[model samples]
Target chain A: MTTESVRVAVAQTVPEFGAVDRNRRRTLEIVRKNADADLVVLPELATTGYVFESESELADLAEPRDGETASAWAEAAAETGTWIVGGVAERAGASYYNSALVVSPDGLEGVYRKVHPWNEEKRWFAAGSDLPVFETPFGRLGVQICNDQWFPEATITQARAGADLIAVPTNWVPNPDGDGRPGDWTAGVHQAVAHADANRVWIACADRAGTERGTAFEGQSVVVAPDGVPAAGPAPADGEHVLAVDCDLARARDKSLTPRDDALADRRPEVYDLG
Target chain B: MTTESVRVAVAQTVPEFGAVDRNRRRTLEIVRKNADADLVVLPELATTGYVFESESELADLAEPRDGETASAWAEAAAETGTWIVGGVAERAGASYYNSALVVSPDGLEGVYRKVHPWNEEKRWFAAGSDLPVFETPFGRLGVQICNDQWFPEATITQARAGADLIAVPTNWVPNPDGDGRPGDWTAGVHQAVAHADANRVWIACADRAGTERGTAFEGQSVVVAPDGVPAAGPAPADGEHVLAVDCDLARARDKSLTPRDDALADRRPEVYDLG
Candidate 1:
């Protein structure tokens, strides 16, 4: 494995419901601005905001894997010689899935569907059947969207599959009491830190900001190091911002939390019995 | 299914290496001091201490599940009408296992061996082959030791098995770069919060303090509510302390994060592909 550092960026943006063009443009702008970074991540459903009024409304906003948003993101990635992971509302024939696309300079790298739909999403999107990790020049990458973060298995599966970095495209909503405690971090941010620490992989969470319909998205996007500490921005909780940090991909490959213990290698799945 | 609250106490104490008597007495003192609490959690290997120099040293300190430590803690639990979960280095037949015992007013309720032994532990202890959750007066209780907290499957399995509360008997060591970030809390604490939030289960972690054989234990014992916020002291980072909080076990039963979403029911195990 190569011991090289890769620049990673997490862009927190706000999108208007049903305003596909504006949302796509906003994400494109963030990518262009953070061109120096090797990878840039955008929030869940960036091109089509969450809080769909109906299945028809969601269907109207959804696109295929090779649709407009993917083409635009691919073009931008090619222009900047960077990789982008962004969320989209995907239409696969009659079913719609909340998905994220991994676009490198070459083109579309992979597509990851939301494995577990959250709340109202159950009504509009079909749950994904698989978790796939993609290969990149810097390292193996895994992409999971939004509510998928709630499942530890999502991160664990990816990390176990040799993913060095997991980019999360999330539209974080507030917790019942509040987003998080002792600081500005949302519960989602803490989850990212825990996932990074537990799996020995870098986790970059790009969360959306501002209110869409009646739902107010939390904007505290964060980039967590393999050591579980926040290496960059949890940005402001309710504003658009960009956070970039240099991550050593090799640290993820060496799952050793210490000389004798490895994070992934140490798992006792025989005892897990995950029923 | 009870909606009533359960008073939980996490006692953080310092144990001298090989001073089993003193450590046991200290634990008894803490239990006696917090007699009002319905449940009390103590650190991993609370009586024997960690950092063994050799296999013989570990063997010398190891005890049967019903040995001195368990008997004493059981007596204390009977006297206080409380339930106690504490770690012990177990001598089972010819093998040694890192394990935790659940003692209640009735007697020894259950035992949980650490599934994932960390670092030097692998050299001395036989890995546990199963994960078990005990039926408690307050709720279904799950117990896991130290490094077991690093594995999400530990918590997920117990939660899925109907555990309302998971008591962690941990001797938290400092991470490669300090224990935790953003505050005095350790990475272990972050893991507790994430587990509680993701599984919708109450998590009470009792950790140890002071240094032993060049190894220092982090003393930030924390009790996280089902909402993923610390309800009581992370105690102090380096001192003996007791953290008590009233946890509504019913909230753990109701895994719903939102009206439309239930944390436990939302899991997609089919896609996990843990291997």
Candidate 2:
């Protein structure tokens, strides 16, 4: 394994609902704060926050892929010489999509829409079909938004497509009993770790913190290693933080669990009834 | 969602390497002790033990699906009126397969050969081609062994085939660094939880305890609910313990995470590149 490592950062910020401009500026500020990182990931809906009351409000907040938020993030990425993946509310013709934009130092490299929308998201955003693996200077990067993390297929697709790391931009809500322990590797974190371990790929989740319109967000932004260990923070349950960790792409590329077992190659697809 | 629940028990007993007779007796004893449980699960290769030395040794220890061990288990199940799921090394004619038998009061209901054998198991056991979901009075039961848990498709296939609970008879070897935490929800446990949460199906992992031939096994046998919480478990890392939990098949049946999201229905199979 080569000693090729990259400093990845997850910016756990509190985004106010419907405040697209403010949220965009706040995301840029978070990026600027962690300027030294090779890659920085922001929470889902970083440009417009989550929990909308009306379709009109959602339509008002949603922007195109090349909107002000992406433009500012692209500018910030150019300035810091770091790649960024952050979620946004996208306006495409008559439909809207919950999407994450991959911005490199050059510009907006790619866009990945949320494949599996959660709860109220169904009413607002159209589900995405493509799981893209974007080529980067450090490694091959993949992106998924919030609820998409719940589906193993999303990560499996990207990992098989040759992604060294998958960036998750999430706005994790508390469990029904309000027992979403962000401090511990609870449900959300466990899913991330399992995905990383099963796929033999690194996963970095950047989750938002704070209550927005009666709904509270669980902010345990973490960077998980291929061995299913959290390399970075579980941050705080309800506080904004920048969790950064040095990730070696070589470790992810080497999928061998043992001399005889390679995680991806070992999969018996012929026997698998995936449908 | 029906109000049907089953008491499931995971027997975390240490099986000595190559001690086929003793292992078989120990498994029967564990089952007899947990006779009150509607369903009981035992560790992988509970009859033959793991970490085989030679082909001849494996052949000598391996029995047919209807061999002595299965017969004993069937007798025990008939006596106790408890359904049982336990791993074994099966000798089908000249071929050896790593398999688990589903024994009811009637007899050996079904046999599931481990589809994904771990490490050196490849040399001795031929991987199976099918993922079976067996029918029981309490619920639909599915079986997978140890390393098969590493593949989500194993559980996904069984769940898709209409399994209420997936029984994982595991011989969890410690990580290379000897850091497989049995108390905490580490890699293996996280996988169980994630599988339960993702599929909205119950997962009972019966992992073995103690060292066998210088290779240590992590116990921490667990019963995970559909919401991804450990319903019972994470038994002592190196101790022989029977961890039991009441599992409501109705909870698994109700796949709805929210008012809008149903786990199984939400799966975007059309978009998944699961090749």
Candidate 3:
């Protein structure tokens, strides 16, 4: 039921606006470089850049699960014998949803739509209705997109659903209101660490670099251990990076924190009213 | 309904084991020092040092809400004309619970028992039944103990209940499994920051310093703003200090993150299923 350890890689790339074909080629290049990776992750909307000027531009760029975005990732996964999970601008019928696609060597394993869309994303895409965790050779995989990280419930739900690693494909931008201070409170890394510490889970956050149109992103991809320690890179804030980590995936399932404490088992759910 | 800005204080101290009388005296000294603070916070099991060997030891130290612990803190509050929230080892009838008490200039306001007790506290203390938010001159106040901070629902519930600040009285110990990295994931400060970021509420975490028996406590007490900024002192890891910050309590009620985003108002509760 387990692969013991997983050699994971995160490809942090900033896609050019509306350049779908060029982005797909660039993705393949990075995937090939990390040929030894068991699991590969990329930034959100990696095929098409974020920040749409209008609905027409979004409609033009968005593709379905079976489209070029999925096909390219599937080809890479099958060729390299790696599992790929990342975000895409998904088209369904007449509507589009921000989605995370899980692709294995076999093909597309599953897709989880971004449950909580960021600011203008509400205008471009419909909100997702379900949280999905896909089964893999290593363990169970839970996926989330940008802005979804802000909601603590998203991680809690996935952790409760038995996710071994929560893959985060994000296009993180600097907070306009954030007054940068030298402490745990001011950094984006805290959010991942908080959830990982509380849930006793592993988290891999792959964030894009460079600016899209007028919007700039913070690139700090990392693989966090169950102990809430960053097992790998936060990458450079402005550089393209291929972050890698060799992790014992089984640690995510072991909730025992102290000799007497089990993080999930010790929880008093009856007293908590999330509704 | 709004008090312009409230000056808050957090007293971080390490109590000597089996020295309740000296601890009480020490508590009064710190309360008198922060006479200008509108609200003050102290650490969990503030009087009785943690790391007990047996139930009999806990039984011997546990006091009633109106016992010496309350009266001493109450006397200080009355003299200072300030409100105080702190943790205590409470004995209700024959049962003991790790509790948070709200004391104002008038008298004892309310008590919130620690719902989620960490490690051996479970064996000694009865679990809490409710999460209470008390109204004060500054704003609504929510209270929690050490291990309770690990749960996001604790903060979310308080934030929804109109809590302006969550006063955390924590006897924080070093992570038994911590690798000592330079990032934010392993620290208790990050958890507060994450919840503060997500809920857009102020958090006052008063952690103790120094070692008790074989266990070491990490100090660094902080007052986090709604934007997840440490508005005050994280004190120091090895020293006993009082941390204070002047904050506009009105910001807690205003969850607006961006022009179109109100952090709490944007939560789609229907989609989130923690179970």
Q: Which candidate do you rate higher for TM-score, 1 or 2?
A: 2
List, residue by residue over A34-61, the lDDT tens digit for candidate 1. 8999999999999888999898898788
RMSD of each: 1.9, 2.0, 1.7
**i-RMS values of the candidates, in order?**
1.9, 2.9, 2.1
**Could you say which candidate leads in lDDT?**
1
Candidate with the greatest DockQ versus the true structure? 1
User: lDDT of each model, Cα atoms only?
Assistant: 0.89, 0.86, 0.84
lDDT, candidate 1, B78-146, per-residue tens: 999999999889999999999998999888887898889988898899988888989887889988888
- Worst 10-residue lDDT window for candidate 1 chain B reads B176-185
Calculate DockQ per candidate and list them: 0.69, 0.61, 0.64
Compute the lDDT of residue B51 as modeled in candidate 3: 80
Model 1: lDDT equals: 0.89
Better of 1 and 3 by TM-score: 3
Please give the distance, in angstroms, between residue B129's alpha carbon in candidate 3 and its true position after superposition.
1.7
Error of 2 at B255 (Å): 1.4
Clash statistics: count for each candidate = 0, 0, 1
Pairs clashing within candidate 2: none
Residue A224 CA error for candidate 2 (Å)?
0.1
